[model samples]
Target: MAKSILIVDDAAFMRMMIKNIVSKNGYDVVGEAENGQVAVELYKKLKPDLVTMDITMPEMNGIEGVKAIRGFDPNANIIMCSAMGQQAMVMEAIQAGAKDFIVKPFQQDRILQAIGRVLARAEQ
Candidate 1:
C-alpha cells in the first residue's frame, strides 16, 4: 500500500514544494494544513501514515502541535521540518514524540530518505 502523508506548513509555497517531492516519490498526500491547529484536526480526521510538520506556524507552533498529536495518538508518525537554524525547537519536537526532523529548504532526496526511514522504523 502507498504510504499516506499529511504536510503542515505556514507557507503555501513550502507545502507545495514538499507535496511535489513526496507525491513524486510514490507516496499519497492525504491532506495538508497551514497551521498547527488545523494540522492537529486534520490528523484526527485523516489518520495519515505520516505527518511532515513545520516548526513555526500560526495558531500553534510545530512543537505544540506535535505535543497535541502525541497526546491524541501516542503512535503518531510525525517528522519536524524547519528552516536552517532551529536546532533547539527541533530537539523539542523529537522529545514531543516526533519520529524525526528534516531541515529546510528540503533537498528532495534527503526529504524522501528521512520519510522512508521514519516509515520503515514505524512499520517494524
Candidate 2:
C-alpha cells in the first residue's frame, strides 16, 4: 500500500504543491493542517505513516509541533519544511524528533528522496 502522509503548512499553496508531488509519486495524503495546533490534532486522528510540516506558522511553530507529535507518538515519522535562513530552527526540529527536513521552494527529486528515505528508515 502507498504510505499515508499528513501535510501541515500555513500556506494553502504550499500544501497543494506538496500534495501534488507526493500523490503523483505514490504517497497518500491523508490530511492537511494550517498550523502546529491543528497538525497535532490531526496527527492523533490520522496516525499517518509520515508528516511533512512547515516551520513558521501561527498558533504553534514546526519545532513545537514536532515536540508535541513526538510526545504522543514517539516513533512518528516527521519531516520539517523550512525556508532559507531557518537552519537553526531546522536543527531544533530534528532534535525535537523530526527525522529529516526539506528546504523550500521544494525540488521534486529532493522531496521524493526525503520521503523515501524517512519512510524506508521507519520500516527497519
Candidate 3:
C-alpha cells in the first residue's frame, strides 16, 4: 500500500510544492494543515504513515507539533521542513522526535528521499 502522508506548512505554495512531489512519487497525501495546531488534530484523525512538517508556522511551530504528536504516539514518523539558516530550530525538532528534516526551496528527489528514509526506519 502507498504510504499515507500529512503535509503541514503555513504557506499554501509550500504545501502545494510538497504535495506535488510526494503524490507523484507514489505517496498518498491523506491530509494537510496550515499550522502545528491543525496538524496535530489532523494527525489524530488521519493517522497517516508519515508527516512532513514546517519548522515555522503561525499558532504553533513544528517543534511543538512534533512534541504534541510524540506525546500521544511515540512512534509517529515526522520529517521537518525548514528554511536554510534555522539550524537551531531544526535541531530542536529532531530532538522532539522528528525522524529527519528537509530544507526549504526543496528538491523533489531530496523530499522523496527523506520520506523514504523516515518511512523505512519506521518499518524496522
Instruction: Provide TM-scores for the models.
Output: 0.96, 0.97, 0.96
Poorest lDDT segment (10 consecutive residues) of candidate 2: 82-91
State each candidate's clash count. Answer: 0, 0, 0
For lDDT, the strongest prediction is 2
Please give, for residues 39-70, the per-residue lDDT of candidate 3 as tens digits. Answer: 99999999999999998899999999999999
State each model's CA lDDT, in order.
0.91, 0.93, 0.92
Residue pairs with backbone overlap in model 1? none
Candidate 1 per-residue C-alpha lDDT over 1-124 given as tens digits, one digit per residue, 9 for 90 to 100: 8999999999999999999998898999999999999999999999999999998898998989999999999999999999845678777888998988888776899899999999999989
Clash pairs (backbone) in predicted model 2:
none
RMSD of each: 0.9, 0.9, 0.9
Per residue, candidate 2 scores C-alpha lDDT tens digits across 3-100 of 99999999999999999999999999999999999999999999999999999999999889999999999999999998854768767888999999
Q: Model 1's lDDT to the true fold?
A: 0.91
Cα deviation in Å at residue 47, candidate 2?
Answer: 0.3
Q: Give the TM-score of candidate 2.
A: 0.97
Count of clashing pairs, candidate 1: 0
How much RMSD separates candidate 2 from the native structure? 0.9
